[model samples]
Target: MDAFYASVEQRDNPDLRGKPIAVGGLGGRGVIAAASYEARKFGVRSAMPSRVALRKCPTLLFVKPTFEKYKAVSNEINAIFHRYTSIVEPLSLDEAFLDVTYSKYEMQSATLIAQEIKNDIRNELSLIASAGVSYNKFLAKIASDQDKPDGLFVIPPEEGPTFIKQLPIEDFFGVGKVTAEKMKANNIFVGEDLLAYSKIELQQMFGKTGSFLYGIARGIDHRKVKATRIRKSVGAEQTFSENINDEISINEKFTQVFEKWWERYENHKLKGRTVTLKIRNFEFETITRSITETEYITNKSDVRQKLTDLMRESIVAGVPIRLIGVSISGFEIEETDTEVQQLTFW
Candidate 1:
């Protein structure tokens, strides 16, 4: 799935084919969630301000995102994957990693399986998908995005190093803008440049990240394909358009945020102990005051009251708060059978 939201629109509507489309809100505060290939040519990109995107391409066709429809298609595509293998790990609604090492079809090679999956997506969903065939998860994920929509890329173990050395550092997974900037300052601009530094030197320069980068540079990733990835943290943070200081105003804001979080936790049936209040003053200094509840949060009103109390105790009326966040920690949401069986035994 490429340009997922916009692609779904194009797939369902024949008239939208090959047309520039922007999905999400089209107003001033709106941001692009997905941009079709045609939209990309016009400088429209995901997470970019709608105002800027429109200025770049005056004729950019704006389409509101229909996540439900996109999710339905995603489910269909995932069903297609399960036909071949059950070890499928979805990164998002549109992207996934499939472990076809032991597949249902008894295929001789992973590349063939990838090709067949791509073809099936196009024929059944009337859309395009790119497939990556590699020996491991890291290489497979990288290879998947190497080619564009309707493409297949395979990285054989024999040519792994040459392939990795030539790959742009920016294209390497987990090497974001921050890492790239540091690498640039150190004159390690690409995979080949990264390969020049010793593992010890890299570790000294980048701490834990150094070793990870070195392994990727050498195409020596040993990470297995993780099928059941769990959440590490679930929190919401927001920066307001302007600072607010009135006690009434801050309480209102905190209440709204707490309500949203409570709903999210309820929908997912998530459990957590820590309740953190993150605040930023008008001068731009940020601070967090968190408390771990003795018992799990089971009510929305309880969280709202606790968060408001922390906000009041932490900041004064004179201090204008620019941002506020309510965060929860120690989420052990998975209701495992072992735990359930223990209860039964008791």
Candidate 2:
């Protein structure tokens, strides 16, 4: 998928097609969720600062996101995937990884499967997609972006090395700007340069990420494509409207967050025990705190109490907090019947 949300918006609304559009915030401190291909020409990109995106593409259309509509479209596309294979792992509302190794469609070629899927998306939904075909997940992911806005790219196993060799270090997966700059400083700019180093040498220099980099350089990825991914955890975190580090201010913010969670999800009858707390310092050192409760809890207040206690103990007064989050996991729901509810009330 490419510019998934923006593409969906453009598909439903004729006016936005071929125009630069952004799907998320257009205000201060907002980050780009998706950028249209037209917007990308002006240097607008997803996860970029919204202010900077405007600076890049001043006339870009800003559409308040319609997640429900997008979700509906997502389900339709997912049905097409299911027709081919049951092993589909959705990465987001837009993107998914499907293993067609044993598909029902009898499609032997990954490239062809990609082509048919792209066609279905365009003809039925009036949207475009970019596809990558490769033997493994990492390589497949890298392949998917080779073309954009209704394009298909393939990376055959034999040609994988040569393709990766010329790619910039910055363009490689998991190499962020800071890491790219570090690699540049070390005079490692391309896959070939990355491949030149022994695994031991790379490990000593880059530490934990060294082995990962080495594997990508040689196209030696061994990661599995898991379709039945369990919901190990469910959590939400926010970078504040304005970043706040003061413990008291963050606690207040936590209360605010808790209040919202309580109002909305509490009534839905969700159950989870192991509550986890996450905090990010001003500099982005993340810390997590977790507590298990005895109850089959659903109310947000109980979750909030666990949250506040965790925050109170962990937060230091002077530090500026950049982000905070709460998560629940490790349980199953006991569905309530109407009779049970009436009995409890009585």
Candidate 3:
């Protein structure tokens, strides 16, 4: 899936095709959820402020996000993956990792499997996808981004070390902006630079994360592609136009959030024993309070009572509340017909 939300909008609308379009909220504090490739050329990107995106591309078309449609497309792709392999690990609504080690088709070529998957997505879903074929997840993820829009890239086991050595430190898995800066300060700017240090030295410098970086630098990732991901929680939150301090307005917002949470919970057919209340104050302080009950919480009264108690403890007369969220966790999920059991080799 390429530029997922924006692409969906473009695919369904004739006028938006091959045009600069952004999909997200269109408010004063709105942010770009996704930007089309056409919009990217104008410096628009996801998570960028809408105002900033407009400044960069004045003619950019702003469309509200349609998550239901995205999820439907995601489910369609998941079904397609299950046709080839059961070992699928979804990274998000748009991307996933499929372990075709023991594919149902018994295909020996991972490259061919990737090609078929990309082709199916294009032909069936009216969408384009870029795929990366590699022996391990770390390398596969890096390879996927090597080419953009509609591309397929592969890294063979024998060529992985050499390929990784040439990559910059920022391109490494789990190396974010802050970590990249720290690596640059320590003169670790590329895989070759990172590999030059001893494992013990890296561990001493970066603690537990140093071990992870060291293994990936050497092109060693032992992680398996897990098939079934248990969703432990479902929650919803709302940001107010203005900070709220009164009890009536607070409860009203909680009721709205509860409706959303319940909708999601029922959709997943899940029940939980724990309820968590999250509060963000006008001063930007965030707080969470959770309680685990003997019986699974299933009704509005149970959730509202717990949330109200937590709010009472956090809300002050003068302090205004900026955000409120309610969540249910510590739940068990039963397997459904749609989910395929993951197969592991080793």
Candidate 4:
């Protein structure tokens, strides 16, 4: 799915096709949820401020997000994935990893399976999808982004190590801005640079994440693709167009966020013990307070009281707030029987 939200908008509306477009709120505090490739050419990107994106692409069209429609399309895409393999791990609404070592269609080559999946999506849904086929998740994930729109790339086992050696440190999956700066400071600017340090040395420099960096630098990813992934937390946040300092206004805003969170919690049928309250002030300072109960919080009043207490403790009086969020975690895991199959080598 290329520029998923924007693509969907374009597919549904002819006027938006081939035009720079963004999907999100078109307000002062709004962020771009997704940007079309046309908009990307002008340096617009998702998570960019709406105003900033507008400046980057003055002709950028803003459309309000239709999440319900996106979710429905995501379900359709997942259904297509199921036709090939049951071992599908969804990263988000737009992307997933499929382990096709023993696919339902009895495909021996993962590349062929990827092409078939891409074709299925395009032919059936009238949308473009890119795919990466590799022996492991890390290389596969990296390869997936190498092409644009309707494209497929394959990284064979023999090419993985050499390919990784020349790759930039910033391009690694887990290397974020802060981590990349630390790596650059240590002269670890590329995968080949990482090879100069031993695992112990890397660990000393990067803490726990160093071990992961060491493995990926050598194209040694041993992670399995799990079909079922347990969600750790469910949360929602709202950014305000105007800052509110008064208690009445703050309470009203908090209630709105709380209601949205409650709706999601009920929809997921989640039972969790911890409730967290998050607040961001006008100065951009953020704070969070949480409460954990001995048992699962089963009622709205109980969660609301916990959030109210957290808000009372965390918020500064007369300080304008710009955002509010609520979340619940520490969910009880229900045991379910799932059959694990041995990988079949071709």
Pick by lDDT: which candidate is best? 4
Among all windows of 10 consecutive residues in model 3, the one with the lowest summed lDDT is 337-346
Please report how far candidate 4 places residue 297 from its true position, in Å. Answer: 6.6
lDDT for predicted candidate 4 compared with the true structure: 0.87
Predictions ranked by TM-score, top down? 4, 1, 3, 2
Reference-based lDDT, residue 182, model 1: 86
Question: How displaced is residue 235 in candidate 2, in Å?
Answer: 2.9
lDDT of 4 at 226: 88
Q: How well is each residue in 1-346 modelled by candidate 3, as lDDT tens digits?
A: 7898898899999999999999984875567889999999999999787788999999999998888999999999999999999899997888899999998999999999999999999999999999999999989989999998898999999999899899998998667787889989999888989888888999898876788778888888877888867665678888787788888998888788878877877776768888788888876677888998888777767667777788888777778987888788767653242222222110
Tens digit of per-residue lDDT, candidate 4, span 1-346: 8999999999999999999999994788888999999999999999888888988888999999999999999999999999999999988889988999999999889999999999999889888999988988989988999998777988999999999999999998767788899999999888999999999999999986788778888999888898987776778888999999898998999999999988888877868888788899977787988888888888899679878988988888888899999988777763242212212110
Error of 2 at 59 (Å): 2.0
Tens-digit lDDT string for candidate 2 (1-346):
6788998888878999989999996578677888888999999988777888998888988988888988898899888888888889876677777788887889789889989988888788777778888887767877777776677888889988888899888777667787889999899988899977989999998886788778888887776666754444455667777778665677777876665544544544556677778888765578999887777666655566667888878888777787777766654642221110100000
Better of 1 and 3 by TM-score: 1
lDDT, candidate 1, 1-346, per-residue tens: 8788898999888888888889984566566889999999988899776788988888888888888999899999999999999998887888888888889999989999988998899889888888888876668878888888777989999878788888877787767787788888999877889888998999998877788778888888776656776654466666666579988887778767766666666765668887788898876677889887778877676777777778778897698986787767566654331110001000
Quote the positional error of residue 320 for candidate 2 in Å.
7.7
**Winner by TM-score:** 4
Q: Over 4 Å off in model 3, which ranges?
A: 231-235, 242-346
Candidate ordering by lDDT (highest first): 4, 3, 1, 2
